[model samples]
Target chain A: MKPEAPMTAEQSLALITRMIDQAKGNVTRNAFYFLLWGWIVLIANLGMFVLIKLSYPYPFAIWLITIPAWAYTMYASFKRQKETSALTHLDSISGWLWITFGVCIITLIAFGYRINFQINPVILLFCSIPTFMSGVILRFTPLKFGGVMFWIFAIVSFIVGHEYQFLSGAAAIAFGYLVPGYLLKRKESQ
Target chain B: MFDELDPLLHSQLRLAVMSLLISAEAAEFTFLKEKTNATAGNLSVQLDKLQEAGYITVEKSFKGKKPLTTCRITTKGIQAFEKYVNTLKQYINK
Candidate 1:
């Protein structure tokens, strides 16, 4: 809103909030995706772990949850596309990097049966790229740490048994995604 | 000691423009105009004032033969803005 009089402190703060929301520099929305996938990965990891322990017939069925999650992610992305028009160069880079990650991860999974479904370590290895790049892009240390966590756990997954890989995945998502996601969200909100 | 709010940024239009640029790597002239609901002539003048103050840099270029003007906030502008906000906060608290 245009003000006829000089801006008050309240007006100034409100204008800052409004403009920041409209700006391409508002990468705070990235926190949403991080938290989303973090929770999903956590659940999927633990679910697979528990299913295997209980001797369930289809431990891999736990991954089916990603189908709904993927649908929701696409819907949210499209909605955001409609709400925002301005995109900074860095934002496009972050976006394209993640898209590339999505493609690579899917290809790995599709061909995973060939390797007897031992794709967890490789998937975690793939995780390092986007996570590290996003951290570098945002200049946030926590996210960079998150990326390194994935690298550590990917190696850890190789040394451990199949069921325990799920545990490491959960740990990785917790420290990696959920922690930085919450921190990033809090920083932006403040 | 109380500090005076920067007069250049105390105005609504200029402050609004600065607010937008402060959060953006860069923004288009049309984006500022549309967001502020200011007319082209008025927005142009406000942008010029900001540029003169060294609070912002405006790059005029072309996109497929159409003139494009983009604005970005400078380091000095960021310092001025932070000071302005801190002063405004003290006044508000008082």
Candidate 2:
């Protein structure tokens, strides 16, 4: 057996600092999830925009793509959980925020038609909550700004006519998801 | 007067491990090894010591065909770590 050496207080403190930094670095490796959802929501919004522009008989039907998107998200989350042996507190909080956001969205969609309100605006409003909270949790300024941008777009969507709401929704996703998602990926790579 | 540090967390490797675990919900054995730059044998010994002291919990399960070991800090461990840090602070201030 190797002899154990006692560590000085300074050395112990340094070791603790280094280990904490390492744990924080590990949290960024999961930035890919932001990219995944960003692309999905972006595509869905653009698709809906095109359908509405073409005067498709069932323009609203395009939103159904989100169903498959949700399914794929569930599958990906489970797969990720299986591959990793540990989760950070940050990871757990971020996951719950998104999950709660998902539940709110599904509830909104299910009951939206009866509320006499435009769904996209409400969705955009709801989107800001989790986006901002995630940004705060991750301590990433870009995400926080992205969340604020979504709120601005949400108000715009509410003021504009229903036909133009899709465009606003698309813009919200662009700023809130795509931009920050790419930034996060770049930060992780560097 | 210098407060006594908890012996279980006084060593370099164990303290480093506790520091990593303090912020995380849990961590894998591989992660600990990678962060600590310790050999598997050495890390296993240190982790066993921590587990025996009730500072951490080790769970063994199979991930597909390979065996997996994950470690999580216990509530007792958190309190001990906090006390250790506070004691260290006192020493530094003195």
Candidate 3:
């Protein structure tokens, strides 16, 4: 095939479309990180809810699981970066968006005591932005809907007491991360 | 009447390479070859031509035991590609 042949406008347009599709097709939708954080946050949220309902003295301590989760996520991200030979615009944008989300979460946790632990709703709200943006970038409707679900849960968490917020957070993680992550993994396999 | 398309971007292989690079921050030589289905020698020649025109920057390094070549489009390349597309549109519209 003469890939260097001169082209008319139609041929040029066709070639452009073909190349863009090829580049997009090469993208590996590895949802491992999403699944990892999904289960971790889901468990943490539900665990906290159960502890609080049981009248445990330090129910909030359950969130300490995030420390180990954060470490694992960093290690995984590094490995993924080393494995990747190309970085697409979507990948760069989504990576930075998640990094920004991570920084925001850390900041919120650092000041959680000052905020009287009324941080769940804000966290859910924050999560929606990156999730929605990621969905848009990847052109995945499930993830976009997942982001909307997070917004709805955030509103619910805001209206409920602190104890109920954990339950809402758990629901948010289930829909926002787990469901879409699974669907993405299935799509990649197919 | 249509403006002339940029010669550097008017060829099939070069245009294909530019299109791929346009959507990516950077791409490896193998990735470009795989996408374009171009032979390594031909791809190397076209890449060198694009580099000489200051349209792309190619970096060579060793990744573990293998040598890796990565290419990124320059600002000039992006502008030229955009102009080429616009000009192509004019030709198609006429």
Tell me the whole-model lDDT of each prediction, alpha carbons only: 0.85, 0.84, 0.89
Q: Per-residue lDDT for B1-94 in model 2, tens only?
A: 6889898898878888899999899899988888788889988999999999999999998888989999999999999999998888887677
Question: Per-residue lDDT tens digits of candidate 3, residues B11-93?
Answer: 98999999999988899999898888889999999999999999999999988899999999999989888999999989988
lDDT of 2 by residue, A56-81 (tens): 88877776767777888899888887
lDDT of 1 by residue, B25-89 (tens): 67788888887888888888888988999999999987657788889889999998889989989
lDDT of candidate 3 over A1-190, digit per residue (tens): 3755768899999999999887776655757877998999999999999998899999889889889989988898888876787788878888888999999999999999998878999999999999888888888998998899999999999999888899999999999999999999888788
Docking class of 2: medium
Interface RMSD of each: 2.6, 2.7, 1.3
Regions of model 3 farther than 4 Å from truth: none
TM-score of chain B of each: 0.96, 0.97, 0.97
Q: Which digits, one per residue and each the tens of the lDDT, describe model 1 over residues A1-190?
A: 4544767788777877787766644453488999999999899999999999999999999999898888898898878754443556567688889889999998998999999999999999899889988998887989999999999999999999999999999998898899999998897788
The lowest-lDDT stretch of 10 consecutive residues in candidate 1 chain B is B19-28
In every candidate, what fraction of the native interface contacts is reproduced?
A: 0.49, 0.62, 0.74
Comparing 2 with 3 on DockQ, the higher-scoring candidate is: 3
Rank ordering of all candidates by TM-score, starting from the highest: 3, 2, 1
| Model 2, residue pairs in steric clash | none
